[model samples]
Target: MDFDEYVAARGQALERFAYVLTGDAHRAQDLTQTALLKAYRHWRRVTAAEHPDAYVRRIVTRSYVDWRRRGSSREEPVDVVPDLPEEGASADPAERVAARDELRRALVTLSPKQRAVLVLRDYEGYDDAAIAATLDCAEASVRSHASRGLARLRAVLSEPTVPEELR
Candidate 1:
């Protein structure tokens, strides 16, 4: 397919992949746009690849890693805290949001490579070989990153949260 067609079919998926990789919607958009621009510059070559989507995804992943390496992605803390759940709100949705927020927090604690490996392996359902190709790393390195990433997440999430009474 041509560049426009490829984007039309895959843009949202690419953006979602980037979001999972970066854990930020705005950064995901920037990463997706950067990758698409690169792909557009060499559309013929990209479309000729065996799996063009994978090619674009590799670009997004690399762009995120490069951006992080340059130290432009550091997050500064905000003085204002988020609103707590409403007193009468149902517990299930609030619990899910809390869990998701905790996961995002845990993800940010990981190194970029570890985050990428975890997202590509677990979130994207890619096998070791595909993750290796996407990250341009050895399969063993991919396995190592995934293991360490998961272990970190477990350590962070499994930490006990003090109850309101305790606090």
Candidate 2:
């Protein structure tokens, strides 16, 4: 596909990948924008690759991993806090939403490399060698990151959520 067509088709997916990698929508948007800009500038080389989607995903993943080295801020700027769930909200769907939110929070606690590794492995279904290639790291590093990241997520997710009354 041409550059514009690629962007038009895969743009939302790219943004979602960035969001999962960064755990912040705003940063994800910035990350996607930056990666796509680079990809556009190198369109020929990217499209010439065996798997152009993986190529662009690598750019997004690597960019997220490298953001720390560039000394970017840890916290995002927000205008206001989000509202709590309504009292009458049903339990089943609310529980699912809460579970997803908890998972997202747990993900953000991992180091950038670990987070990227887990997302690519568990979320995106990439194999070890593919993850290594995308992250430009060793296979051993990918395994290490994945193991440590899973352990961390387990620890975080296992913690008890304090009741509103207790808080």
Candidate 3:
């Protein structure tokens, strides 16, 4: 497929991948844009690869890691907590949102490589070999990262939820 067609078909997926990797929408957009730009510059080479999407995804993951290493991705603390839905509000959606937010918070606590391994293996459903390829690490390293990442996530998520009144 041509570069433009490939992008049109896969841009949103790439953006979502970036968002999962970075845990920030704005950062995800920037990461995706940067990766796509780089990929565009080598479009012929990328498209010639057996799995072009994998090539682009590797770019996104590497770009995120590099951007974080440069220390330009400072996370600002939220000064105010948003009000939770009122009592008797639709319970399921609220619970799902809270759980998702909790998970996201837990994810951000992981080291970048661990988080990338976890996301690629668990969220993106990639195998260890594929994750190793994406992260440019050994298969054993990918397994190690995923194991540590999951352990950390479980530790974070299992912490007792703070009472609402405590806020």
In candidate 3 the C-alpha lDDT for residue 4 amounts to: 87
C-alpha lDDT of residue 125 in model 3: 93
Using lDDT as the yardstick, the better of models 2 and 3 is 2
Clashes of each: 0, 0, 0
Residue by residue across 1-167, what tens digits does model 3's lDDT show? 99889989999999999998887888999999999999999999998999999999999988887787787655543323333334565478976687667666666677788988888887789999999999898999998988888887777666565667886
Q: List the residue pairs that clash in candidate 3.
A: none
Q: Measure candidate 3: CA RMSD.
A: 4.5
Task: Give the per-residue lDDT of model 2 (tens digit) for 53-141.
Answer: 99999999999989955877455432222333345553679666876665665665678888888899988999999999998889999
Query: How do all the candidates rank in terms of lDDT, highest first?
Result: 2, 1, 3
Query: Over the stretch 35-101, how does candidate 1's per-residue lDDT look in tens digits?
Result: 9999999998898899999999989989988888888764542222333334554367976687667
Give the Å error, residue 148, model 2: 0.4
Q: RMSD of candidate 1 to the true fold?
A: 5.0
**CA lDDT, candidate 1, residue 43:** 90
- The whole-model C-alpha lDDT of candidate 2 against the native structure comes to 0.82
